[model samples]
Target chain A: MITAEQKPIDEIRNMIAPYKRILALGCGSCVAECAAGGEKETAMLASALRMAAKINGEEVIIEEKTIDRQCVNEFVIPLDDIMEKYDAVLSLGCGAGVQAVADMFPEVPVIPALNTEFMGETKDQGYWVESCIGCGDCMLYYFGGVCPLTRCAKHLLNGPCGGSMDGRCEVDPDVPCAWQLIIDRLSRFGALDRLEKIYPPKDWSKKEGCGPRKIVREDQQK
Target chain B: MNNVSRLKKVLENGEFAVTAECGPPRGADPESVVKKAKLLKNNVDSVNVTDNQTAIVRMSSLAACALIQGMGLDSVLQMVVRDRNRIALQSDILGASALGIRNLLCLSGDHQSFGNQGQAKGVFDLDSIQFVRVAKNMRDEKVILGGDPLSSPPDMFIGATANPFADPIQFRAVRLAKKIEAGADFIQTQCIYNLDRFETWLNMLRERGLTEKTFILGGVTPLKSPGMAKYMNNKVAGIDVPEELIKRMEGVPKDKQRKEGINICVETILRLKEMPGVKGVHIMAIEWEEAVGEIVERSGLLPRPSFD
Candidate 1:
């Protein structure tokens, strides 16, 4: 899942104020579960926009549409007719959905209503916390299902830093020390010996900041 | 306090208060609704425009309130804090007040599961009690969440909901007390069918010393038909119609069921008026506003006290 928080309603109202005909698009995938952009949020945004327009004494036409997955081409294709009708599209999906909409509807301006924070899961109802970084590597096996690369504030791979106090990370007292969690998990799994093995420094080039990464499944390809 | 204080003064002066509810259309067309507002302008003291009743999207509450106010009607803008954050809610309150919509009903609202957008995410940032607290905070201290005094705080009457028929009637008083403690000035209860139960709940409120602090408006919604009675019984939570009343509706012919429903509502209101704690009655005719005049007249509440 991708963690996101909705932008302030006033900010969203201002962003789409210029367009008379606007389509509030939502994605039912990651953002829906996170309570950022989904079908419900799209309707809310549309209602808020209409209210804001009435207050400003401006006439605006707003339409709401939600796709199962706006990050994929299959979902974006269904919006072709509505995309042609609207002057602008306000995407409530995550960053990927905005990009996909933009790619599909180059003629219309695509705006985002959410700030995609990180990849995470719903810790509970109405609460989502970060869990993974998608670092293009599998380190959870060695760490016994804990990924220090993502959970650690400093992204420390081997062990906890000196800043760790009472098993809590110094950067955020609420958070447990990622390396400590890693050690606890490994010991429980009878893999404590893995920590004694000196692992080589991770190559930063394979991460997201480098460039666009691709994975082609030869078996599935034509 | 401005207009609300004035309105309170009018009520205290023994004026027969009048209020009408304006249900927004299901779509964007506001002409018919505005026409309805015009019709009620001469009859009611204030028009209570609902905010997406049942959690379904409609013309916004604020917009409808503004339109009614613009049409020369005092507006009681209904607000549901189920979807808005503190900032948006406060700003909207201020905005509506600026547009001359003074009265407000603070509601937690129907859950989204009952609406067309059941899968839609709901943002219940603050419940009814918290909403009243926020409104009172803005009114008394003029301070917001960031501890900054607002330039001009809104002067709006805060109203909350109470249900006598809600299972475990003690919890209703407890929640009502909480709302009052949170600074709710008034309460509009769920539809009252059982007058004895309602009076008992009122006595409990008096025993708890809550009756003196807040004004309690007994809610009265006339059932249109047997189907409506069944719908309220099965679908609406916290509202339990007595089996006798259901039997009455079931016994009546289809064409005469609506008349029976109105008679039941009028009888309930008359009984409620004789009760000590009730300040007035809020008639929720649902989609049957035409029967409201008859109910009010039948209850002998007509020739309402002059505000002018």
Candidate 2:
């Protein structure tokens, strides 16, 4: 799922500095599961902003609202009528959520409240870890189902980079090296010989090209 | 840009080239950097100016390399992929080379969470492998990425880091081959205290003839105390310190621990020089720069070569 962490209140305050009337919008899906954004998050943020404004003697009003999923246009359409009343919107969702709101309401400035972290699963109650790079091409089946593209710091295709030690990544000793986990799982599965075959350099063109990606369905389309 | 070719020349000359690391300070002051460089000016073949080594913010390696060059020391500027994107990386390569800094060490730096600025975002657009390929192409091919011709290309002796101690140890030498395939001319390895495992890594390199492809500089850092040995063994990633070595350090008296540290480093240096495929030693004295000259001298690498 898409994950993010809330931006510090001071930075969020600076982002919406130009607008006095703003919408503290949230998305119910993905981000809500991560507790980054949801109806509860939106209400809490609205209350905090109100308190901050009161303490600073600033004239500001934040109206909270949440949609099913801000990445879709249908969920963002609900903001059309209310958006006219506010000068700007503060999206308490992932980056996709902010963009979706902006794509719908081109005139009102849409501010991001969280820094979209990565596509990962919930490790513990509040902790999360990245697991996928969304590289468009999936090669997880080959590397014992571990996504080196996302988990490995270098995204090395051949094997682990020279930074991993004791099954931990060199970048941060806390995180498990993706390649290590792959090697272990593959070794246990008696497929260690499969690791000798080196995959070629990933073609980034398929992943993050110059523009947005699209999957057309000719048969399903009118 | 004209390449400052002293380090390359030394390695090609086949007379064991010795390189040492001088970390750029955290502040803007260059006085200490100049002093440190001057201290090792007559002792080592080349000095590697680190790019925010250990993920901590420091004076930019490029600026520090320029400063080291001004002191008449060959400067190998370390470039990590943690901070800059491809555009900024290529631009800095041009800027550094134009300033007469030649040797470039490509690295995927330690993560930002380890440093004082944990809140900073890391921008690793290209990993060290891809970064090495990009740098070599820019220098040798005389063209920027995407086939754009450059007005003038920067001449550089491309280098990369290696970790003989990283897990999946069987693949370490093979990874070095990949780096060589990416056009790495020289490799400065992670710190070495365990000789048997290092020998195993070298055996793989020798079997594949990768030893002949690039000059391998085994990294060595003197143990200041048993605590340091324990910390490196337990805390530092890609570093494996053997228990016997730590026991040896622990056997020493409290005041003599520093002496034992130098002795162990000297011994490691001797063994590294005798080992096959090992070209030299990269002495990382950390902030204890004063001990570098002594370690080099005791290791019988004194009276550095002077090429007219």
Candidate 3:
């Protein structure tokens, strides 16, 4: 899941300052699961904005609406009728959702209300940890299912550097050293010998330097 | 024979080698590097010029090594993976060779948060081991990464670092073996204050027959004061200065602590010389290069071997 946190209320308020009438849009997907942007959050944000506007002696009209999966074009069709009623759409969604909403309604400006963090897992209640970097090429099998490229602070492949102490990273004491986890897991499976062979340099072109990555499935595209 | 590096020749000749570090100045001053190199000249086998050590911006290691070479000393160009990608790393390897640098120390440098630039983006495109393999291929295989042939390869005696005191202590030697297997011609360890733990790590290397594969240089740093000892033990990531050694430094008078520190360093170097797999001692004087000559002389490692 993509985890995100709502931007500061002041910043969001300023972004919507240019528009007298605005629509606070929300996505009921990843942002909703993270408790960042959903129907409940949208209502709360709208109420807060109204109160702030009143205190500032500004006469502004704000409306709230949430749709299922704002990134999908089919789910965004419901907003096409009412989008023209506002000067701008405050998108309480991930980056992709904001872009998708903007693509759907060309007249109304789509502004992000939440800062998209990373592709992560809900480790515990109110605790999220990054798990993937979407490197396109995966070598989790050799590393006992732990992704060194994503987890390691240095993204070290061969082994732990001289910095791993007390099973923690030198970069951050809180973060566990990825190589320690790799070694421990490989040792448990008696596969520690797998690390003997030196892993070569990563092919970063497959990751993201050249341009925006795209997938073209010929059968599904039409 | 593989390269013209004096350190390689000393180690290959089965003679105990000695190397010390020379950190570049914060500003663009080449004279500071020259002064440090001159102090270490004829006192050590090779001088390691650190690259943005502790993530603080300083003169580049390549430029410093070139300066040291100008002082008529063999230089080990310390390249860290934290700042440069593979392309820059490979390009610098060739450039260093062109400037007469013979040895290379590939390191995963200290994290940027530890340095002046805490917000700097760390460029770890290739880790230390990968850098070693890359340098070795550029030297032995006469090719760059992706097997592209170079017009001329960098003549380098590849080196890497090991921390015997780091956590999951049992796996420390295994990591060292991986580096040796990755074509690290030499291994320089994190500073050793806990001799027992270092011996255990060295024994692990011996058990795996890694002792015979590559030269191992134990690291030693002369503590300037008791506070310095405590700081290293508590703050430094991989270093573990034993409490007893700290007490030894504290026991000495304020004016005599520096002398006591040199005594302790000499003792550590002597112990390292007697160890089976330990081939040499790398004295990282850490901005106190003036004390290196005294420490080396007291350790009875004088009349430093010269291949010229």
Candidate 4:
């Protein structure tokens, strides 16, 4: 899941100050799951912006709209006819979704209303935690599903880092030690020997080292 | 010799080594590096040059290490994985070696949050243990990361850091062993203040015979003042300043607190020298290089042993 939070209302107001009429586009996927850029969030944001502008004596029109998934081309095609009616688009989506909308409508300005955090899961009610780095090479099988790359403060392949006290990281007492979790999980499965073997340096070329990563599967291509 | 580092020679010859740190200036100016190097000249065996230390922007550590060599001193080029990819790190290793750099210290680097440039993106493409393995490969196999052979390998003595005070303290030795297995020639630890804990960690290292596989340099810094002691205790990660030591500093007068700090550092050096598997001391002195000479003299690590 991609986690995000709404930007301060003031910042959003500033972004739409010059535009008299705007579209508050919500992403019904990841951002919606996180309650950041869903249909409900877009309507509330649009209403709040209209009230704020009216109170400030600014004639601004905000229209609420949501697509199934802003990152998909098919989901974004519906806005093509009405994109020109708004001065700009206030996208309540992740970075990918915002860029997707921008890619579809080259002339309309797409402003992000939420900051895309990371690929994570909702840990509690209204709380989310990052769990993966999307490194292209998945090693979760080795660590019993614990991700040192995403959870360790130092991203140490060989860790616990002398900073793992009471199963928490030194960077923050609130954060659990990723390695500690791995160790416990491995122990439960009686695979402690796996950690004894030294892991080589991460092959970054296969990961994020070369640059922005892409997975092109020729076999899956039409 | 596989490495030309004087510190390596001292350790191999069974002599106590003294390595000091020199942080590059924030700007391109080499004035501060040069001054610090001169102050530490002959007082220590080799100097450890830090890279973008604390995540702050500074003169490149490669340039600073080269400058230290120009000062007629051996420099342990400290490279962090936080900012460089394999291409840049490997390239720097080759260049640093070509520039006559013999010692290298691999680190994952301090988090960018600890530095002035919090917005800077950290490139932890490889962790410290991985960095050590690559450095070793570059030197022994005479190859780049992808197994392409090099004309001549860098005669580099690879080193990494250990923080005994970090949580799961018992795992520190295992982590150290992993680094050594990954091909670290030496290990310099985070600053040491808790002697009892350090002793236990050393015992763990020795029990596993990790002490014999790689040279271990204990890190020590003078506490400076009560405030600094408290800050290190409460703020700094991977560092543990025992309450007794902090109380010792607070026991002294404000003007004399600096001396108390030096006294504590000297005490640490003496104990570390006697401890099993301890090869030497790496005095950080963090911006207090002038006191290094005095600390070395007081700690009786002076008249540095020469294998030359």
Candidate that would win on TM-score: 3
TM-score of chain B of each: 0.93, 0.98, 0.98, 0.97
lDDT of 3 by residue, A1-222 (tens): 888899999999989899998999988989898899999999999899999999999999999999989899999988878877899999999999999999988888889999999999988888898989899999999999999988998888886877888789888999999989999999999999898787888888898878989889899976
Q: Estimate candidate 1's alpha-carbon lDDT, on a 0 to 1 scale.
A: 0.76
Clashing pairs in model 3? none
DockQ of each: 0.02, 0.36, 0.74, 0.58
> How do the residues B1-308 of candidate 1 rate in per-residue lDDT, one tens digit apiece?
24453334445664545566779998888796887786665555667788888779889999988887777667777888657766798899888878877777887666565677878766555555667777888877898755789998887877777777653343446556767887778788878777777778888999988878887778878987777788887656556677788889999899898899999988887787777777777777777677777777788877655545
- The TM-score of predicted model 1 comes to 0.58
- Please tell me which model should have the higher lDDT, number 1 or number 3: 3
Give the count of colliding residue pairs in each prediction.
0, 0, 0, 6
Instruction: Spell out the clash pairs found in candidate 4.
Output: A162-B166, A162-B167, A163-B166, A163-B167, A164-B167, A164-B168
Q: Of the candidates shown, which would achieve the greatest lDDT relative to the real structure?
A: 3
* Candidate 4 global lDDT: 0.88
lDDT of 3 at B224: 96
Q: Per-residue CA lDDT of candidate 1, range A35-134, in tens?
A: 8898998898789888878988999998898999988898799788667789999999899899999999898989899999999878889887788878
DockQ of 1: 0.02
Better of 2 and 4 by TM-score: 4
Better of 1 and 2 by lDDT: 2
Off by over 4 Å in 4: A14-21, A56-61, A73-89, A101-111, A162-166, A205-222, B1-3
